[model samples]
Target chain A: MTKISAEGICKSFAGPRQRVEAVRSFSLDVREGEFVCLVGPSGCGKSTFLRIVAGLMEATSGRLEIHRDAEDGRPLNSMVFQEYAVFPWKTVSENVAFGLAMRNVPRKERDARTAEWIDRVGLRRFAHHYPHQLSGGMRQRVGIARALANDPEILLMDEPLGALDAQTRTVLQEELLRIWQSRRKTVMYVTHSIEEAVLLGDRVVLMTAHPGTNKAEFTVPLERPRTLQTTTDPQFSRLSYQIWEELRDEVQRSMEENA
Target chain B: MSSGGQRNRTREEDGKAHTGAGLMSPAAGTVLLRWVALFVLFNGAMTVLRLWEPLWWAAALVNFVLLVRIAEQGALLVPARFARTYERSLAVAFPLVLLAGWQLVVGAEILSPTWFPPPTRIVRALWELATGFDEFTGTSLFGRPWEIPARLAEDGLKDGAAAFTAESHLFATLMRVFAGFAIGAVPGVLLGMVMGVSRTVRAMVDATLSAFYVLPKIAIFPIMMLVFPNPFGEGPKIAVVAISAFFLVAINTMVGVRDIEPVYLEAGRNYGATGRRMFRHVIIPAALPVIFGGLRIALGTALIVIIAIEFVRSRTGVGYLTFYYWEILSPDKMYAGLVVVMILGVGLTTGLKALERVVMPWRRDPGRSDPGG
Candidate 1:
């Protein structure tokens, strides 16, 4: 079953002198429990498209539908943002429990679920710590845990580990794979890293530079339950290189457009 | 690679040598000795020649600089383990040294005792004011704390006994400050939050608020008096105080709300936080640090306005007491009242700090070790 169906999505912003088109006629279908990564250059509007799907931004013109299963009490979607948007004023457990609290889940269940997610993210000991008290990687863990604990129908991630160091990013990618394997939640992941797109996604969708639109798509040939060592596999490198070759011109075009 | 290793080793040695030189610098001892010698020489010349009065001031300034440098050097000598404690003690001791110097200057007849009263005399006056009631003004500093229970017992709760307990200068000033603060800050924060969230509201009121914010609140006292029915009573005084605090807190709260990172708001909305939930979870907490900053500044302003008002019109406040002693030409008692004001300022600020700590546990210094990793 298709969990999300977005067609001809176009987003534009009012600039000082003209209407700046951020995304143009983007169309994609995410299957239930399938992980899809949108790989693009800077200013490709991948994040804009994700935000439209998240309902944080309105598409100038589009048909977007998130298919909800009947009798499912979970939310339509929950997003893990690029900035690790965990509340600095809240503790680790509190931030994880935020969505549940917003949904007015009872205290006992909230605490139980919050604790489980905190432990899963390996932040059990820092449950009472604030975001400032945690490292960048640890903070992003809280962000991931916050989204996952919400138990949404579709998980939307916009460069969730983009702010982390390379080593931390690798570790989090493995953790993300491990988590996705267990639950098999429908996820829409956006990233500028082709390697990340290849490592994590079942299918990688490439986007154009300015006025971003779907350019191409590729199926990941990597095996499931992947880890850091998967990157060493010959197939993974070949796929990543192929995606980079397609993306290289788009990155150059984006730089020129920005200039 | 070998050359790189040798270069690194040489740099490490140079760093160590620099640190060693800094710690045992020969100039440190000579610097202090030079200053002390200059100070002594200047004072000796002043005493012997009985030079110009301006030259005496210059010698005194040299003496003051020498004392400060000595203190700084002395602080360096303290062990690292007790460094913080030593610094705190020096803060207290430096003031005491200044007071002692004042006392010596007065005792030596360099300064008139009547004008620049010694610290001991001021302390004595403070005790008297604290303990004794004044028949002329019908006021006291503490309002007879020991007799409160007896008065209440005889007069009962309904029959004006509460007035006796609230009769002191300190009590009057405190009541005005707290009442005005509460009255002003609550509405200010609400209005600020509204303005912060809504750009239309902010644009509409920003100019008007800025206009009132810059006007000296004390300058509007006459207008406050005219607005209040009982101009001579506490109404006008408190109104002025409330107005001052309101503008400060409102402007600050608006800024606080406006300054919240947009990503947090997006996250809040993404997580299904709407309206009140958004406010409670995301908006309020994000803006709290700045709100508290505004509150602290507003509090200081409130105190300043109240003191100035008391100095002008009121008869039952620390400001009135200080002004009264000035009128009577009792410098000691005036200094004592000033001391009480200082104490009140410190006490109120400390209380606010404690409240800030309670409200903002997340802002506490993160000294905890990473137990997870």
Candidate 2:
């Protein structure tokens, strides 16, 4: 049940000063419903990697595939972006129902499905509210609900909770865990936070800058129903510290290069 | 920025400190007191000069309270306490404080007020204009003296001004502004939306419009006159308003579209929306506030064009009426016509402001309770 495989992927960006290799020789295989985390320094191609898998951008050179066999007929992967991307004018219900609306779902069913998902994200109160009225965390929940509404087999999230506060971030993380448990879609979550990677990810892909590529992957041995309290456990700390050590040098190197 | 036509900007900025619940500060108190004193002084002088009634004081007081309320809310008030702006000493007040001062100068033979008569004369002139539709009734059919209003009156409008009713010269001029606005604004909105979404289109438009935008459109008046027929009537005037407004709205819409975050576009794409779907659901709503901003700017520009065109040559619009009075050198009627033009302009702007509230109710500027006025 392979959800997606990116074999020998690479990404490069052209800058005014010079050509920058943001990712190179990055390879990974995610199983169906496996929650994978791409953790790295700021300039590392975690987002680039996620984008390639989501079919938003083509990798410089790689083989990418989705499990076409799954009768879902929804796309191989869909993404929930960071920042406030919810269409401001549409109600929360419309945003959640966007994919089905695109597919021309009958108005009644779209309403029902949208209501269900809106309630799933605990935004039932704000189902008719515009995104501008909602807080940043609430807006992010809209983004999450929008992504999940499609029932895509694979969901790619790029620093989805980075813009939120500590309290909101933890709440959303638990929400993500609960949602992931129920639906079990393959997820590639990108982040600069090591703690986030440890808490939510099943396999953390620690990446580095300067020809960004996978440095190592650690399988989280800890159990879920995971929370911020889980981050205090010795196992979570050991894994996070290891990932930090892998990212430490690359981050400093990136800062110097950027400066 | 709009040519200091309004003398008081800080009046509102100062008033902001003394809202419904706030402790009205020292500076706020001084401004309010000054306004009140000015209202009293202006009316007191007028009362003294005209052998004016005690009722004038009540009117002046009501105006003052409303004026303070308007200044407090940073909004304009109808029945504005204009007299309150002159509340210093009646003896030393400026010439045009309440038109009483102007009347005194004219009556006392200090200066010929034929150039700037008192407001009472202007009000008298307005009353005359309303009744005597015989003399100043807007002439129709250009070459002939066909009375458009008389014909309308023969049909109906027992009480309404015949010549000023719909299908008359005044209504005709209004229709031109609206028709031209729609012509320009519709194209402006569509083209602007396209340009806003695409960098290539935006770049193309920016280069072209910036050139024409800076070239004062008045310069084109001569060129347009030569190209069209002798009568600058509805055709050239409408074209002028449309183009003037078109650029403002188009550019604003472009900015609105261009300014939308990449995130929203991607969200649309992620949901399987492409091309028209993306534009319809994603870009348009995202760009509405900016588009409306353009529309507002275009409306003001359209009015400006209407005035300038009539000033150049015409009969019947408020602008044309002003020019006719100016030609006859009747300052009272000319000032009266100018007041009419001002009322129309204010009415149009206020109408569009109300429209903006209805159309894009979600549009908001950050931290402000209201979206915009």
The residue-by-residue lDDT of candidate 1 on B17-55, one tens digit each, is: 766567433444555576577667866777788663445
Proportion of native contacts present in model 2: 0.41
Every model's DockQ, to 2 decimals?
0.67, 0.42
* Model 2 regions more than 4 Å off: B1-112, B130-169, B202-205, B229-231, B364-373
Best by DockQ: 1
Tell me the tens digit of each residue's lDDT in model 2 across A1-259. Answer: 7778778898887889997777899999999879999888887878888878877777888787776766645666678898787888887888889988887878997788888889998888778777777888888899899888877778899999998888888888888888887887889999989889989999999887767797888999989767668878999989888888888898998899789
TM-score of 2: 0.80
Which tens-of-lDDT digit does each residue in B193-287 have in candidate 2? 87876778887778898787777765676677776786455677787778887888888888898888878887788788988888888888888
Per prediction, fnat is 0.62, 0.41
Interface RMSD of each: 1.7, 6.3
Worst 10 residues of 2 chain B by lDDT: B364-373
